[model samples]
Target: MGNITGFMEHQKVPLHYRDPMERIKDWNEIATLPTEEILREQASRCMDCAVPFCQDGTQLAGMTTGCPVYNLIPEWNDLVYKGRWKEAYHRLSRTNPFPEFTGRACPAPCEGGCVATLATDSVTIKNIERAIIDKAFEEGWVQPNIPKHRTGKKVAVIGSGPAGLACASVLNQHGHQVTVYERADRIGGLLTYGIPKTKIEQYVVDRRIRLMEEEGIAFVTNTEVGKQLQMDQLHSENDAVILCIGSTRPRDLNIPGRNQKGIHFAMDYLHQNTKSLLDSNFADEEFINAEGKDVIVIGGGDTATDCVTTAVRQNCKSLVQFDIYPIRPTKRAEDNPWPQYPVIHKVDTGQEEAKHVFGNDPRAFATTAQGFTSDKYGNITGVKSVNIKTKFNEKGEKIRDIVPGTEKIWSAQLVLLAIGFSGPETGLIKQTKVALNNQSNIKVKKDTFQTDEEGIFAAGDARTGASLIVWAIQEGKEAAMECHHYLMRNVS
Candidate 1:
């Protein structure tokens, strides 16, 4: 508690974003850093509550309420307030391996659980976190933590996303030989390709990868475990294997005219655009182009928002996003009390950018795509949609029913389905013969990350389905600890 009354003295200072119109013209990060003085004042706002729910990382009402990685929020905030940024970074990094990625992408459940938020706005924990790390990098405080001795235990991590990277990071720090296998052409998995450059620049990801490489963790890109390298060979070579391959199966909207040429999966669209943008700055014309097209993004989530913003940057003529569920109230409902992730409506950056470009918010709530209307060339010309009302069944399950006579068609040249993912792709799972849960995720014992197969474990979305980056990191770290204990006990 650097400043006991800091929360009363300082008002929350929100992070600024670059002008939306100007930012849409290029593919750079939109967030602008706060001044050092402003950041310090913001950090001072941490009341350092007795319970400190911000770092509790508890699950309430079936939703995350705090930092999933259990970041020492108040400690770091006090350190930052006292101008000890390097120490703050060290404290922040004690739990979270990659603050940069989470700083940019995470929804910051910590703020929602902040004690200050009960009375007023919460402290700017996310911005303070990012500032501490950014300052650490600038001051040359960030460096590779090479292990002092080799445990000689080899671990193979499949997938180079946050989960894989965090697992490999911890195992390597424990003196184990860690190797990451990424099926993509480059490392960082979704962090590298799935997320747009505007949210988290590729260079930020590259910087961490470089540090990891320097710390003796080897990354093999363009090599898939089930295909290029035999799964049996991987199991035979590595002492233990951790599957961090995230849920890759995208949920599809099956309806009439589904075979249209312009209708593409959201990941396909985002991945190709990022690949091409990094390859030749999109000069090669290798990615999907949305220029002068009426784009309709199906499913309202982060991916749908990304698609909407990406289409706007591509100079799309118009845009609209469909949400099958009804819009959430601006204020939390009676059932959604404080510290439950606050199920309320809020505009994300993509929708903000869309509004700036299209003169209105692009989201149409309680609406679903009924079918696709295609032109003679088999290209998407428009989307037929209908209003829906949600009702709960006797079993407490929600059901969506279309409102009669509310069908309408919205012109759309391109349709991107961002509904979400089903589970890890079946190819690798089948090749490895791992048992899957009812939801198609890898089945693992509670607190024990080991799967059905011996010496094999699963973490992240591979086991938990699609989730936040913070949760994935936490799972990866937990899986690494369990795997380490198992190897020490049995392998040797």
Candidate 2:
């Protein structure tokens, strides 16, 4: 428990983000960390509640609430309040393997499920968690935790994303020789490529990678599992094979002019941008440049917002984002209540930046692109869109009715499709012949996460389709436990 009266005395402190104008000029972190003094006070807002749901995350009405990694939010908050930064970091590390990544990128369902939120704004759990880890790194408390003993077993982890990295880290700590295989040229899969530098910097990722290397985890980049390295090689060489390839097959728009040259999936754009930035600081011109063009983002999810932010930083001449769904209420609707993740309107960093630069929010709610317009040479010129109303039919089926007069043309030279992903790619799945669920993701047995193929397991998006980073980390840890038990059966 923190100071008994601290919750009442201190209101939640807002995050201090760099001015939009200033941030758009460069690619540095947009949010500035408040001083330790300020963070300590913010940590005090963890009220002593009868039921601290902040630490216990679960799905409510199909939405995530609280810490998916099951972080000891209250315990760490109390420690931070007592100025026990190192202890706080240790407590945080007990549940979450990568607090640095979650602290910066996670949406913090803990805040939404905070008991304090029932009466007022929730405690700044995410910020406090990040502060502890950041402070730990600064004081050199974070070092390689290399296991002294070896199991003489090997686990090959495919993909370098959060799930794969988490799995590899835990398995390495378990003293199994772990070699993480990544298809990309660099380590840190989604952490490096999928996530933008504006969110989690490359240095943060590189630092963790270096520590993992120090801790005896072998990383092989630019190596895909079933292609460059044969499928049987992993099976014959390792005790277990873990698939964390992620749900990379993007869901695309198959509408008119879909073949336009300027249109690209959100992930491809983000990956190239980050890689270009890291590889040569954008000097290579490998990324899809949005500078001085009318950019239309064709989705309204987090990925779409990322596209918006990236375009803003790239100095797009004008921008528009389309959200197929209706605008959420500023306050939670009647169907939405406390402790459950509130589906309220949130203005994320991307929208904030776009609004600051464009004189208004860029989102066009209840709208979707009907087709693309193209110039003579086939480069995109604009998009044809229509606004619609969504309603539930008698059978509880949702339907979207186009509003007749709302069809319009949006001028654009660049179109980014941030619609979402379908599932993991078919190449590895076909080569491995892993059974798939109805959703096209790898079919995993309940709890065990083992595929139909013995000694082969799946976790993260590859198993569950697209999901949160926090969830992916949790799955990776759990899969590691199950994988460890399976491997031990063969150890003797």
Candidate 3:
């Protein structure tokens, strides 16, 4: 343990971000890396306990509590504290192949499960991890994992998202020729389009893509497997196929006056902005322009928050968010004990940016959209909102119950729905002859990621539902192992 009393002596240094007012002017990343001294002090606070719950990497109370990829948090903490960054990178890469991605985007469940958090705040494991990798890239320590020999076996990964990348990365290291196919023009599916640029910059993703290409992994973008390239052709050409296509079908809010012009899906809005920004820095003006409009974002999740930030940058006239659920407790409740992910209030960057410009918090808690109020041209002019309260149904299931006489209309020119995704789109997937469960997710064996058909497998959000990036990565690595075993069965 580096300084046995460090946890008691040092207070947790919070993650730093660019100024809200200043950052809203550009699409650059909001976070700012801490100095080496500050990061080392934060690393010192890890405690290095005999049983480090921070690395447990399991679910508690139906929520992720720790690093899902089973990161070696304590060991890396000690290494960072002692100026052993290269060694720290080695240990960090042992479990997580791409710390840079997780470090920037992950929610840091590891901090919630830390032993130190029982008394004090947890260590800044996420920031330290990002630092280790960033330093590794700066020092030329990060490199391609080119295999010594090829097995002459070809594997086709039908998504370029995190899960697909992780699976393809492992297979490539195992001497298998891995080819990742992305429908979008870009290599990263969600990382490139679904996530906003303010969180993860494009250059970071591009840098990793370049390295993976150097490792002999072939990436085919702008060409879908089932459409441009037929599934029969993919099956006939490749030895095996793996589907990492993520949960993509956005859930819709089918309410009165729903077919209005101004209302749009959150991902659609975000995707247009990013594609335009990357294409011509938004000069082409081919994207949705929220300028001089009262924007109302619906649903309460990361996607909703992302919509808020995106609108703020577009110079919206006014902003407000509608969350159906009530505001979460500022502190953990009695039932939410230690070692569980704390469900509490958080002022995300989007909210902070809106407040900086609007002079107040823009969230309306315990509220939901009853319907839309449109103008003569069928454009959304306002939202008919009603206050809601959580109630238990006859089957003891939670349901939203409307409060009487609490219905009101709020002015809005733009409405973005961020309710969340339902499941993966099955149009192209069904062509592979793989069976899907009732939830529209690809069905796999209990342990293996193999689908109903031989030599066909699935993983990540396509197999599960829409989930955290860390969980998708974990599934990808494990799925790759099973696939490798299947491929080598006939060998010596």
lDDT of 3: 0.92
Please estimate how well model 2 matches the true structure, expressed as its whole-model Cα lDDT: 0.90
List, residue by residue over 58-152, the lDDT tens digit for candidate 2: 99978899888889888889899999998998898899989999999898899999999878899888888888999999999999998999999
lDDT of 1: 0.91
Q: Candidate 2 has which clashing residue pairs, if any?
A: 160-189
Q: How would you encode candidate 3's per-residue C-alpha lDDT over 1-492 as one tens digit per residue?
A: 787678998999987998898999999999988899999998999886878888878889889998899999999999999999999999999999889999999999998898898888888888998999999999999988889999999999999999999999999999999999999999888899988999999999999999999999999998987789998889888988999999999999989989998999999999999999999999999898899999999988999999999999999999999998899999999989988998889999999999999998889999999899998999999999999999889997889889999999999999999998888888777787688888888988776799998899998999989889999999899999999999989988
Write out the backbone clash pairs for model 3. Answer: none
After superposing candidate 1 on the true structure, give the runs of residues whose Cα lies further than 4 Å from its correct spot: 490-492
Q: What is the lDDT of residue 168 in candidate 1?
A: 98
Question: What's the number of clashes in each of the models?
Answer: 0, 1, 0
lDDT of each: 0.91, 0.90, 0.92
What's the CA RMSD for each of the models? Answer: 1.2, 1.1, 1.1
Which 10 successive residues of model 1 have the least lDDT summed? 483-492
